[model samples]
Target: MKTQTTVRRSKYAPSVVTKNDLLELLNADFTRECRAIYAHAVYAERTRSRDEGAAARIARYGQETVLSALVLCELIYDYGGTVINNLDELNAVLNADRVADPGWAPETARRLHERAGQLRSAGEPGLAKRIRRIISAKKGAVPLAALVSGQQAVAGR
Candidate 1:
């Protein structure tokens, strides 16, 4: 049997960054310093929790998971730079398994995706690309798979 592929366009066209752009950003001294600091803090927090086993406790109870999800939602909403107009759509998009397990409701996901697309169109290329990748990875529709594959191919891996 033969299969055909179809392309689906993002509702908004946001600028995207090349690997070179990311490399350049990473190579900057200021950026390196900031990254180092962030890494250190993350490590320290994790290390300190090791003694009390708070990390294990949190993980066992799902507190960390819940907090992480909340943080993700806030970060996406803030960075997407647009308010999701349709709660239902947003839930659907977020709930799609490819994007997340026990995902956001379909409506929530759709709204989030729409907002993320708007951010992509607003010159926040990196954030937009991240959102697009998240949605694509969730494996919802054929168009998304095509786009993800196309991206991987372009990356020459």
Candidate 2:
């Protein structure tokens, strides 16, 4: 029997990702989802009076992000891990005390893409495929314009 704890890098991890790499990825993703929900809520609250449409959209997005977090949490548990619950860890940057930094979501997507590539290179193609699905669920990089103008940013919207 083998037991594994969090190990830094893990780039040399086996193709299966049974160690801490995939666990770490899933946890990081959960943290991102938490940040998304927080930012969306803040934006929605601040924009409600001036942009009810955007507020509503933000609320919906927040809900969707919650689902994403739950999914990631489930994965973490199934993979023999605990969901990180550090408040200070779920951090995001906003401008004007209201607007979400335009780069946040796309940066997240970019990191996820990079992680997927790493997983593929490490011989964990199946896990890489899962990450791709999460990226596809975003349609593409979320444009700040969509949040302000109530544009359809999510795919099939």
Candidate 3:
């Protein structure tokens, strides 16, 4: 017997999710969180004296990102997944440009968002939604895509 609820649930199920897929997704998420923590801490250091409130908010988001990463670590382990051991390798694999330019924090967020969209397209909407939350937390002070475009405009000026 078919029910509307069952059909809806079936539509939303992750048809393509696998241990390997989850491992890759979690690794990418882990890298994003690590970089976000660094970026926010650096932002706080760079602008703390000028804008204490903003710096505090950014630092708080960084802490939240740490928590998210911890949750992700648990999820990955539950799925029999392994995390990257070397931070440099993680950064290089995820965002070498971010390492070269810490100011590219917003771009990093955008990149994560895009990656999440890809996950969604690949039938991993749950993971995509989680990644979106991380992106939102990372972009605590400003909308990441808007911030990046604004910076580009200013640079062009």
Candidate 4:
């Protein structure tokens, strides 16, 4: 009897993540860290599509907003800047956390906001509106559905 050889496939392949899968992954890290990463990634992707000038501006703003949020979260836990006062100190802590895993840089946050402003001023009101909606949603300032009404009101004027 002759034996046939079997072919083996590589174990690595791209995997798709559903909304629930992403939610589950969020549980793996602290909520603050998760939120920072999510915001940073969104900002990065948005800036990546812009021109150099626009990209730089958006990146700056994005970094600022995300860093601000992170700092706010820390303050909420540590009771109002009792521990850290400046971005440098905050960055030191963030850098350490990033070494163990991955995190956003302050610069990245700033650029995102700048790009967003550029988009708004460049007559891309629809895109700007979307960005504002995303920011508001991420910051929990308003509900996703309510964002539509808010945008409509602004656009109406």
Of the candidates shown, which would achieve the greatest TM-score relative to the real structure?
2
The candidate 4 region of ten consecutive residues with least summed lDDT is: 78-87
lDDT tens per residue, model 1, 1-157: 4446556555565334453443232223122222222322332244343333432332232332233234344444544332222224434333332422123235334644654555555556676565555455434432222332343354454
Which regions of candidate 4 fall more than 4 Å away from where they truly are? 1-37, 80-157
TM-score of each: 0.27, 0.65, 0.52, 0.25
- From the highest TM-score down, the ranking of the candidates is 2, 3, 1, 4
Residue 15 CA displacement from its true place in model 3, Å: 7.1
lDDT of 2 at 10: 61
- Counting clashing residue pairs in each candidate, in order, gives 23, 0, 0, 22
RMSD of 3: 8.0
- Model 1 worst lDDT run, 10 consecutive residues: 25-34
Count of backbone collisions in candidate 2:
0
Q: Per-residue lDDT of 45-130 in model 4, one digit per residue for the tens?
A: 44354344433443454455455455434423332212222334445334432422322333333333443454444444554455
Candidate 2 residue-wise lDDT, 95-154, digit = tens: 322325556667777777776676677666776777777778776435443574443343
Per-candidate alpha-carbon RMSD to the true structure: 17.1, 9.3, 8.0, 18.0
User: Best candidate per lDDT, number?
Assistant: 2
Tens digits of per-residue lDDT for model 3, 1-157 = 8767674534334344555765786687676666656654665564477656655665665577567677666655655678863356444435533532545556666656665665676666776777777677655645322333444454466
